[model samples]
Target: MGKIRIGVIGCGSIAKHRHLPEYAANNEVEIVALCDKVEERAAELAKEYGARSYKDYEELLKSDDIDAVSVCTPNYLHAPISIAALAAGKHVLCEKPMAISEEEAQQMITAAENNNRKLMIAHNQRFVPSHVRAREIIESGEAGKIYSFRTSFGHGGPEGWSADGKDSWFFKKEQAFIGAMGDLGVHKTDLLRYLLGEEFTEVAALVETSAKKGSTVDDSAVCVLKTESGIIGTLAASWSYVAKEDNSTIIYGEKAILRLEEDPAYSLIVQYQTGETVKYELGGIQTNESGGQSNSLVVDHFIDSIRQDTEPAISGAEGLKSLRVVLAALKSNETKKFAEI
Candidate 1:
């Protein structure tokens, strides 16, 4: 009850760069164990954080000293590890796209419900200052009813981050399910939903593996989405951008258009039809690390939620809603038509 004892399920790049460091910074949390299939990686991170290491996630879950866990494993392992952690009576923060399919996502939700534990998805974009500010402005009727949006996220690929480069699980269909859609696409999809305060009801999409040859999953994809409230938007995500564009979203409304960029240098801009424009200086908003400011904010939110016994900003149900959008996009691509949510 003093400090929330935590365990990390995967000692990969995300864990090392984001979750581990953020957790360590939070005085309310104490990292107790690190787990990874690669024993050396787990040991390395454990030594760095002054925590115990385990090759088996199950062993870490069995530890009574651990009150919560962060699941940073490959896409396919998300649901299993999360379900196990919840069933073990630990609060869980699972890295996004929630799960590859709706069925798996449902199982994770049900397990958390049955165990009465907090289940949050790491859709860190929701925690970004620019995004949070945009949501506030939109909700205040300052934008005057959002009509449309365009968003994108792209990068050179996982080669620089993953230890195995193109051979990493990100390129494997069995492990990752979909390539760019699950990786970069999910973030934008969730962001669009968050900014608009609407759910995606249908999607028309196109997907390809043009950039990364021999990759089992898609390397690029674009989708058109129709929200339940009649808002329309486009989302494009790719692992093929030559110089790394990160993520950005533009929202159009009757009175103004708001533009948000992950790059702090440009900050966020809102242009009103009445010939007035306002810009926010987001000095520390961008970073070379994946998720960047969003990750740190999300980790802080999770720790606060555990301490306060409140639901997270991005709950399990919200995560499932975003995953449904991605799945619908994939289905639309395969069928070459609009797919309903």
Candidate 2:
């Protein structure tokens, strides 16, 4: 209603680097509570935001002062925390890779539906300026008859991005579930669905712990996905990009190939088969490797959805569908065959 009362459920790196700061800056939101298993982390962010700190998330959810919460907790806790918050009558903005399984994800969606509260997944890549523009071009038939694509997202590792650094739970299999596939691959999964406007029907994957020593979960994965439209693409996610990060996508169409975030100078470029190329200087992507500016476009959109009393752009059902694609990839890795999504 009046300046949405916001509570942050995790005080780790995402909360530090993105959620907390972004929420604090939003005029439509007021940071009312902060929570983390680490008391000091919660207290530190609470002190700065003029909010209460809680070691227990249930306490934060119990407070009527909060109208909504951003669930930035680890992968294992996403569904539980978001469902709890929703059941407590709080709108939820959950971090990506919605949950460990499609069933868990569905439960989270059901919770939101039962509570009549808004639920938005923080798939921030869709908010990137160049990506938004690329969607426009593709939809306009400029990138005609898109038949193939290759998209990748990679960086040093979660240790460099998480607030807990190398000691972060991100590497732990039990806590983080699927590693790079969960952390980075899902973003591309959702992004491709957004760009190609199709759902992945089947996938074949090689999930491996090719890099990183501490974690038992996979550190890298290469998946071949065939969308409902019969469009095929390679989706690669890795935590071993020691040289640099590559958050680029090439959408191949009959007329031209649209390259996104491949070059730093220009965020998007279209190379036509007619021996012509067009480059646009849209802003770059914000990744641990790239080191760029990123706004809380996802957060802002969530708030807008709340105020307007409408469904979020990235609703629970939408998130569930994307997560299913990821689960299918994991299954493919195990089965050594194409897995149906």
Candidate 3:
């Protein structure tokens, strides 16, 4: 009903860059609390936003002023904190790679159901202009039946982007669960599912930690995904791309081929089998470098869902489906064989 009182649970780079700013931008949101284990970080943001600061998320969840929370914590905390927030009768907007396992993700969904609170995942790629247009083209049958695809999201590393810099929890297996796959890979998997409108049935992967010295988690990974309709594709995520960020996807269809975020001038391109090409000047996808501060639309969407009493576009169940793909990829990597989802 009134402005949605928001509580941000992490003051990391993700919160600084995406969640906090985006939530502030939404007129329907009033950020009432900021929390982080690092008290100074939370206090600094609290000062700027005029919100209360807490080092413990449980305390923030107890506040009657907050109606919702953004779970911007690390991979491991995403589950427990989200479950707790939902149980506290607060809506939750969790960061991607929802949980370390399917069981935990399912628990989150169940928590939301039991509490009658919304549970949304911050899968921002679904909001990108190019991706929205790509989904439109494919679903319109203008691209015909999808045959294959290859999508990738990569940047130098999280060191420059994470709040803790080189010592960020992103490099710790206990904290992050998985590295590049969790950070970047899951974004592509979610995007692929959004574009294809199908669930991945099988996966084969080669996940490694070849780069980023002393890191205990993977820095590079390549996974082959097959959809329920038998369409196949490759998904690549990496922290080893030292040059520039690459957030591009190419889809092959019976009548046309679509390219997304492949060119600096145009974000979406379609080439018809009839010797004609079309290019769209949709806005650019946000990257890790400069000009990456664009709105992700996740925070606003979460608030909108809560306000409208509707299920989020990226609901907990939708997030769980995408998480299953990443988990299957990890299983495939370990077994050295195809893993069924």
Identify the candidate with maximal TM-score. Answer: 3
For each candidate, give its TM-score against the true structure: 0.96, 0.98, 0.99
lDDT score, candidate 1:
0.88
1-341 per-residue lDDT for model 2 (tens digits): 58999999999888888887778778988898999999999998899889999999999899988999999999999999999999999999999889999889999999999999999999999899889999999999987899999999998898888887888888998999989999999999999999998888999999999788868999899999998889998999999988889899999999999999999899999999899999999877887743444774888899999999999989999999889988999999999999998
- Sort by lDDT, top down from the best: 3, 2, 1
TM-score of candidate 1 versus the correct structure, residues matched by position: 0.96
Worst-scoring 10-residue span by lDDT in model 1 = 286-295
What's the best-to-worst order under TM-score?
Answer: 3, 2, 1
- Tell me the spans in candidate 3 whose CA falls farther than 4 Å from its real position: none
Whole-model Cα lDDT per candidate? 0.88, 0.91, 0.94
| Tens digits of per-residue lDDT for model 3, 1-341 | 88999999999999999899898899998999999999999999999999999999999999998999999999999999999999999999999899999999999999999999999999999999999999999999999999999999899999989999999999999999999999999999999999999999999999999999999999999999999999999999999999989999999999999999999999999999999999999888877797459887888888889988999999999999999999999999999999999
lDDT of 2: 0.91
Return whichever of 1 and 3 wins on TM-score.
3
Q: What is candidate 2's TM-score against the reference?
A: 0.98
Q: What lDDT score is found at residue 129 in candidate 3?
A: 98
